[model samples]
Target: MTRPLLSLTNVTVAAGRAATAKPVLDGVSLSLAPREIVGVVGASGSGKTVLSKAVVNWLEPPLTMRSGEVLFEGRDIYALRGADMRILRQRISYVGANPMGALDPTLPVGAQIVEKMRAVVPGTSRRTAERRIIELLDAVRIPSARNRFHDYPAQFSGGMMQRALIVDALVTNPVLLVADNVTQPLDVTVAAQVIRLMKELTTTFDTAVLFVSSSLPVAREACSRILVMDEGRIVEEQSTDDLVERPVYPYTRELIRQTPKIWGETVSTSRHDDQREVVLSLRDASQSYKVRKKTGFGGVNLVRAVRNVAFDIRRGDSFAIVGESGCGKSTLMRLLCRLELPSSGQILCAGRDIATLKGRSLLEFRGKLQMVLQDPFGSLPPRTAVGKMLEGPLRTHGWRVEARIRERVLKVMGEVGLPTELYEQLPLGLSAGQRQRINVARALVLEPEILIMDETLSALDQAEQFKLLDLFEKLQKEYDLTYIFISHDLAMVRKACNRVAVMYLGEVFELADNERLFFDPGHPYTKALLSAMPTLEPRRYRPEECLLEGEPPSPLDIPAGCSFRSRCPQAVDKCSRLQPSLTVRERQDFAACHLVLPPTASGGIGGVGTTVP
Candidate 1:
């Protein structure tokens, strides 16, 4: 048998001083063979991240390796010093969760990677390093690798930034790679692409990978062997299939249970009712901005963030808008909330154009349509108490009685699952789920008719998400609230949303009921998204046939014909010269594709044929 490439023998990691320290990783032992992929999965505070950091000796400050040994190629890495330590670091690479903060913002992204390369391998020339970095960038499927070399970190999309970080990790040809929740911040399609790239690179580079994530499905997609962690202990370890199918521990089974299913048995009931009133409507709405060029010279490019988008959200409907990063989901959310008026066309709220509202009318509109932003902690004022934070919205709308305000605040807090005891406490050190509940309570305090949730559940673990979703369902039924969910999580959408709209490059590619969109999608883009969704069930759409290549074109330089044609697998000659308009393909189901023939034109609604179960 081959010797393990990396080994941790009874490792114990702790945080804080020796007397009062708490063990974050308790007696964890694991081994990794060359070219093997291992996954460590658990909930938020279960020590998954701590284990990854311990493996790479990246732990600092209060985090200390209290005992045991970490052996790389049969040698203890902790004892290495000076030049030996440098060599060990060169043999291992660590990629973190947040990509935007990974690189230096003041320097070019590629240049920073090249600098690291030169440092690790001394005597390397700049020209030689640049050529290799660009090659790795191309190998990672970064579009226009040569041109993007000069671009700063801010210019790259979230997916592109992540791929760039991978390039940085793999540039040195390390023997081991530590990836800590690297795909949590990406869209489903982009995350799938990154997972595939990592698998390919593991074979290509003969490197072992330690994939740590809070999401089991994502880890199962990338790793061969799995370890389940809970409360700083490895509760179970087994092959990926066995662990998922036959979990031995109760914690492991609960983790699997909490993972949202895409195509499994669902409890969602059809809630669409045509007689329902139209709470919000968008009529040919479009938004644009002038952005500066990459060159220092004075020049600007027109970025059409949203273009002629049309949709009607009915009362008490859970509507969803989904797409990959840079596909204009945020821009659409801003328009719907009236934070930014559309450049052209109208956004109607209860048959009244929101653009024409002013003064009291605008304030009333704001109260009627409240928004719950994505970042739970960042959205809250850190220093303010939860009670005061909730009261601000009430006071802004002319509530003078403090007694009544306190009564209302406590009532809303209880409705959102926040304990009344937390009213006097700051948001500091609260769990992500609790912080998010505060955000929800703040929105609910306004007694809004519509609530727009922009990736509200993306930052949470699966268990928290599952609980919060249940809470949302109860609240919606009790309050008769209409929810607008802007997210890339298809599983959550599958469970919660009644109507769905698939967006791509500032255009809605398909609009249909959730059942039709998942079972019989009408457009190629929507199919690709469904295919890329991570799930444990047998996939209806095979990813090999439906997954897209590279990334979508920049909004500033969108393709002339179909905005999505550049990445569409079934694009034909007609798609290059004429753009398809959103038209009905079936009963009330709309698709923007020339290939999709309406039911009247064909024997049935046919485009890209339906998936086989």
Candidate 2:
């Protein structure tokens, strides 16, 4: 029995003085058997995340686990002594939902990994620790483990960095590995890839995994047993298959219905394509970040984020690009809108190459292609009125200062569901969802033909995601606008995208219809990515799910082969030796991995040292 790897007996987390701050967790109890994978699901602020943090012996300050006992291998963890507890803590790791919080910019990623590894083994020399580090990196599929081991956090992309942090968490080989909202943000394919990797890692190590997320479908796919929490209380618990088949709780059923799947009405939209032409087109589009040292290690650090990645956005079309955090999804969005110019690529917008435009031309182009960034808070200025925020873009584009701008602001704000009184209120004064409304209103002000949405819905509530998604579709159809939807949430991508492109390590690994990409994936990397999507679809089980543990290669040290070959389940000997170029796989579907197609007749990927000329 192994005495059940871990168990929470009558766990309750309270925030205020004993009877003051309400309880965040209410008598929640769960147990994990050795090597068993369990998932906890709930809405945001449902206390699922709080419960894991409590169990990992990290209640931090002011917050206490109240009366619950956290048992690790039959021993009470909350009652453990300082040094003794640290030892136990070293054996149990928590990979948080927020990756940015875990990484320290001052240190290189490799050193960070090794540093965690060194903690578990006391006199282990740096060299020995480094060796273990290599093995660990190898396990995560981070190519050139030795070279990147010393690279700082800034060197990695969002998903790669997340993977690195996960590797660091697993460095201790803990009996209990708790993952919070691990794959909710990834697109179906990329999310699927990450999910598969996590499952594989947990399986290979025979570690008990506790997955916490707000997605019921995701939890259903990743865990055999599922627990549903609402407002900090466990309302339902059952086997994954049983729950999906017969959910006893109404809220749980509603959650499953809303969870985005490969092809589902995750969000209902009335947008029809007959309303308009191609709004924005990228012909051989590429974007390079002249790195020039991310943290002062200068000389030559330019990153060609999106190299020769091509796609189009038709009028009223939602073209979603899905990838792990750092897979150039945002870069592609920026490049398409000319927010960042391509080193050598043509972005034809309204039949003009906006890449070479400058001065007034560039300024005017900005009005036509507005971007709604991922962080809504980041979108607004401090003490700036939401009304003024909307008017600035209008004013910048030469909108009159009179009643016209005010009228436009008030109207768009209303469309976003904000009150007219909010016109003068600062963005800081509003709630999270309201601030996002401001973001949407501001972007729609210019009524740009092309809207580059970079993770715009990531911070909003599910209800909010649905609202904004509806607003986007309505506007798209009404104004005949185009959208380049960038997100990690695959379900959203599936629901939103007419066409989808999957990016990996700054390259488009696969591009196709959303259904084709998810259902009949041709690229091995694409298949792995789809498999990695944490799905509640119990019927679509694959053994490869257990092999997706490693992170992607560093963009700086990208492998010469297919960018995804390192993690591709179908990777062959030819993968590492040659690069894979994007080509038509089936119908409109395109992929860059050799696992899907053979190397080109030229004997290698077209260009050398660069992705596409």
Best by lDDT: 1
Each candidate: RMSD to true structure? 2.2, 6.0
Clashes counted in candidate 1 amount to 0
Which lDDT tens digits does candidate 2 get at residues 402-520?
89888888888777688898777766656667777777788888877778888888765565676677787778777777788888776567667777888877777777776666666
Q: Per-prediction count of colliding residue pairs?
A: 0, 25
Which 10-residue span in candidate 1 carries the lowest summed lDDT? 604-613
**Each prediction's TM-score versus the true structure:** 0.96, 0.81
Q: Write the per-residue lDDT of candidate 1 for residues 241-329, one digit (tens) a residue.
A: 99989999999999888887777776474555788999999999999999988778989999999989999999999999999999889
Model 2, which residues run further than 4 Å from truth? Answer: 1-5, 18-20, 60-67, 73-76, 113-128, 185-206, 261-276, 288-304, 323-327, 382-385, 398-406, 419-433, 459-464, 502-528, 538-613
